[model samples]
Target: MATKHEILSEIDTNFPEYLTFLQTFIRAASPSPPGDTTEAASIVFDFLSSHGISAETIAPQPHMPNIVTDFDGGDRSGPRVVLNGHIDTYPVGNPDEWKHGGPYSGYNDGLQIHGRGGVDMKAGTAASTIAYILLKKRAQKLKGSVALTVASDEETGGKWGTRYLLEQGGKASPWRGDCVINGEPGGLQSIRFGEKGTLRLTFTIRTKGANGAYTQLSRGANIIAAQLIQRLLEIESMTPHLSEELRKHFDSSEVRLVANEIMGPGTAEILLAPTINIGTIRGGFKVNVIPEECVFEADVRLPIGLLAEEVMDHVYSILKDFPEASVSKQEAPSNPANYCSIDHPFAKHIADTTEHITGRRPVQLAGLGGTDCKFYRYLGIPAYVIGPSPRSMGASGEAVDIAEFKALIKIHTLAIWDYLGSNA
Candidate 1:
């Protein structure tokens, strides 16, 4: 049996190969919206095949392929572990806005890898791929299987990606695993066990149109829009009920201190309350005209233990004051807040492994944003996230420190081995 140090020493010796893999992955542009992950999936398939690991491409939609592969353990009765990461990245808005490199440049300064998806996820995906290969080499000595799932359609919501793979109600879905470890750039200092839910609402206001000179005579739709914005902002103050176990974890001095370090000051409060963001607004055709109709969108995120229905009730209660404004749930994707206990065996093993590697114990917290892990949680399988803290996720100058990237890979490799090898 290879000790943890032996496994890490091997990873360190082959760090260059891992770095090259990540650079190649970053160079392949798999942006969501027109999310065509075939190019990236092909890269993954080729890499796995070259290393004697059998993999297959499953594309429910054209050009959106999901790469699935697995290594069997010695004991077939042991649990199966899933290693997951998204291939598609947020679309780079404007290439010219990038001061460092173009979105797909995959520029490496021997210190950091710069590109749109470098940190947002391609790096994590690359790490998981390498980790899977490492685990495969030791499969004969292990007691469970390790399944690798590189998914598409995460940035724009995973309707055609993870959701289809795991919950399409199909008979022979290949995504069935006992637990999932998603490498989604949550930072090495934290192991995210939960994520906030999304409820996007679009508010529309319509009123009688009138000329610009008609003051106090016309009901301006813009005025009603402004009032709705005020009410939406108030949702931030609404408190959420946290489970006693979660609350106890949050109140711990260690967790609070680590949360502040990883997520910035006041992050604790943000995680405990519902958050509202007015994403978009469109109204008048001209500056002078009293607009007859105005529309705006608000993105509401519910904390763990908070139901979307409860948040909607609060929204409706606030809307009562603005009778002229009508709001409707948009076609935007949404799900209730999901979580797994911090005390779960898988979570604890990850935390212990992380501490062993980094000497800094990771804090367990509810993720502020969403990830493909939510789908696994929906299936009652516990999912956890631990990866590099992306310096630039969706904006220009996106990159991940190469040092941290390697460290992240080490963490994933060690943790996966620790978890799957426990039953050996």
Candidate 2:
């Protein structure tokens, strides 16, 4: 069954050494908020130990580590396949707002391959290290065992790579897996069957006292922090909104025209809305009398089956008439949704292997920000998301598509032999 044009002509004769090992692994700049990545995880552990595979880096602390590699087939106790990524990024924000040249410049104009983890992920770690070297050179008697992790602080929320590899059982060692794949750009024609459940709360409001006294009295805690920031903009325009799979995912119409072009049209028709941010505001430390107080911070976000204690009980029932207003939960709330059900057979084998290699039909949106599939749905492990991003791939002259990097190593070497049934 190896005829996707003979696996894209053997990944087009190993596409110029996989684009020169992804431009020397995206110029080894490793940007994870200075969480550095040990020279890009030592160039993927010296290119998977020069191909024989059995590499390791796994640093829980000594500054940016998490490399871990292993390649073995034929009964390592069958069914195991992990291929995560994230050699850190998300900081090259403004190398002069680069349209072309900046941030560890790994440029290559012969049909794209630019910079900044080129397409948000060093092209899914160079397509999972060329699909595990073409699935150990065409499934050499496949049975199990295959890990190629490279993670590290997944753009800030994996407190140092997959939560330090699940706090160092490293997923119960031997690179445990019964199906795990996270080459996260997710635009290589879709396979992300879930996402959208992040809770960030920060509500700080203070006002009380006197600096110079009586310039016209009436202070009452800076007028109850301006009527509790206008009742948190009416509890951020009504909190108890989203219902049933987050209100049929914002009641489509292209998701209400992309949420009325990013929260406009009267706050996006307030349709099942649940995101509010007054970001930050400081109190009056001066500027004369009645300068009692005025501090505010709001950044609430919730959607997927909304329940961060019912959004802090609808934000204390919309500040239950401000009894000297006060509430603080900067980030304790978390829901981690994306329920995985498109008749889950690992979501129809990643939506029929991304429409059998992209004839287009993969946009089943909802990740709306937040990955590491929410810590593998807090470890039940039915994660989802595919890779090889490409539609004008992350803009600003961004790139990474030397022919979709050989069609993402021939669709992950036939999606790891159709996700491990392997009759090979």
Candidate 3:
């Protein structure tokens, strides 16, 4: 039997090959909103198949393929660990805006891998893929199996990706696992146990139809939309009740210090409040036109312990001030907040592995952004996220530190072994 130290050393020896795989993945473009992940999925499928790991590509929609594979251990009585990663990335707005290189350049400058998805996911995805491959080589020494789901369409929302794979009503859904470890960037110093829920609502203000020339008689929809935006901004100041567990952690000086180091200042306050962002507004057809209908979309992220209905009630209260504005819950895309206990055995194992590998204990924190991990939590499976720090996740010069990337791979590899290898 190979010791954990030996396995880590093996990873160190093959670190260059892993970097190549990451770079190759970054080179393949799979941006959302026209998210065609066939090229990227092929890269993953080919790599896994060539390494003697069986994988299949499943696509509910054309041009968007998800790769699923597993390694069966000799013993079937132990826990099953699922390693997941999203292949699609945020779209690159303009190539000229990138300071390092093009979004798909996959540029490496000795200390970082520079690309659009390098930090946001491709680095983490590559790490998961490499870890599965490494573990398969030692499958005979394990007690449980390991599964991989390289999903697509996570950025815009995972309706067609992880959500479909897990809830598509089939025994062969390929999402069977006792716990899931998602490779989404959460910084090396923290492991995300929960994430805030998302609720996107578009408010449409309708007025009596009028021609562009008749400004005096028309009740301008654009004016109403502007007033709604002002009122929606007030939700930021309203704080919600935090869970007892979260409040306890927030009161800790050590946790606050760690959170400040990882996420910025006032991290505790942000986690306890529902954040609202006015995403888009479309109203007038021309400068002089008073449109009959004006629509504006707002994205509301509910914190843990706050229900969507409660937030919607609060929103309704605000909307009462403007009778012209209304919301249709059926048209809104919403999901309640989900979380796993920080004291969960699997979460503890990940933190322990991080401490063992890097000499620093990871802080337990709630993720500000949504991820496919939420879907697993919805399925009653505990999911945790740990990856390299995202320096420029959705920005132009996105990249991941080479050192952090290497450390992430070691941490994940060791943690998976510790979890699936032990009978407890």
Best by TM-score: 1
Measured on C-alpha atoms, candidate 2 has an lDDT of 0.65
lDDT per prediction?
Answer: 0.83, 0.65, 0.83
Across 337-362, the per-residue lDDT of candidate 2 in tens digits comes to 55454444545666666677777545
- List clashing residue pairs in candidate 3: none
TM-score of 2: 0.35
Better of 1 and 2 by lDDT: 1
Candidates 1 and 3, the one with greater TM-score: 1
Off by over 4 Å in 2: 17-101, 107-114, 117-192, 198-209, 212-281, 285-295, 299-305, 312-314, 321-337, 342-348, 351-384, 388-409, 412-424
RMSD of each: 1.7, 18.2, 2.3
Query: Which residue pairs collide in model 2, if any?
Result: 153-161
Across 112-191, the per-residue lDDT of candidate 1 in tens digits comes to: 88888988899888888888898888787777788998989998888878887887556355576888887787788899
Full-model lDDT, candidate 3: 0.83
Better candidate by TM-score, 2 or 3 = 3
State model 1's lDDT.
0.83
Total clashing pairs for each candidate: 0, 1, 0
